[model samples]
Target: MNRFTTMRILRNIVLLLTVLTNIGCDQISKDMVRKHISYYEHISVVRHHFTLTNVENTGAFLSLGNEWPSPVREILLVVLPIIALIAGLAVILFKQGLSALFRLGASCVIGGGIGNIIDRAVRGSVTDFLHLKFGIFQTGIFNLADVSIMVGTFLVMYSFYKDRNPSPKLPA
Candidate 1:
């Protein structure tokens, strides 16, 4: 194989590996939480600062559409997300000129989306089991998939910013 062909093959393998790793971590954490923690049963992980509790969210983030009608919920939550994830995967895999960091971020977003989609499809809800409270700051109960998505979003934004405002080169 030519050098370009070999590099492309290697890149594809790395992309798939990163995405699968994110999905695996999310699924494993959720499985552990489901097996060990009962719904709403809070267990302190770090004094009053952090806690673990199980919740099955049938809606999007923060349970925003939990009360929506069945058809709307299905279309918005499952169908739309599936379509978006497919497009995201295509972009990361095919789009040229994307930095490694950008591709990694996009892969993470897709991976997390797949993880939650699996839960929603198989279990009819997404399992969330971690919460944090520090002084005046508090967070809704969340899971590893949510963390992946948030971190991925941050990385993607940072990538764009870095590209736009690149550092000046020092005199050689």
Candidate 2:
């Protein structure tokens, strides 16, 4: 095979592996949570700081806009993910020569989005388990897919920051 063909094959393989790994992680974590924890039950893992709790979220983060009618909820929860996945795939395919960090970030976002989309489509809800609490403040319950997306977002932000301000060098 020509060099271009070989490189393309390698890139595809890498992307596939990245996607599979993310999806697998999300699924396994959700499975474990479902098996071990009861819904709405909280198990403190770290002394009022962190907990493993089971929550089925029918809507998006923090259960936002959940009071909508059933059809609207389904469209917002299910159809939107499908659209985002398609858009993300298009960007991944058409955008070329992106920095390595940006590519990694895009892969992660796509992977996590696909994972959650699968859950929402098949289960009618997203399984969230992790819970963090400190003092009187508490963050929303989230799952592995959420973690992946958050990391991807940070990576994208970092890449943009680096691009805008390339590192300065010391005098030799």
Candidate 1 residue-wise lDDT at 96: 83
Collision pairs in model 1: none
The candidate scoring highest on TM-score is 1
In the range 1-172, model 2's lDDT, one tens digit per residue, is: 9997787668767866877789999999999999989999989899969999998988888988567788898787788878987787666655666676776777788888888888888897899999898999998899999989899889888998988899899899
Candidate 2 local distance difference test against the native: 0.84
Question: Which candidate tops lDDT?
Answer: 1
Q: What does candidate 1's lDDT look like per residue over 1-172, in tens digits?
A: 9998798779878988988999999999999999999889999989979999999999989998999998898889999999999999988888888998898888888889999999988898999998999999999999999998998998999999999999999999
Clashing pairs in 2: none
Give TM per candidate: 0.97, 0.89
**What TM-score, to 2 decimals, does candidate 2 have?**
0.89
User: For each candidate, what is the lDDT?
Assistant: 0.92, 0.84
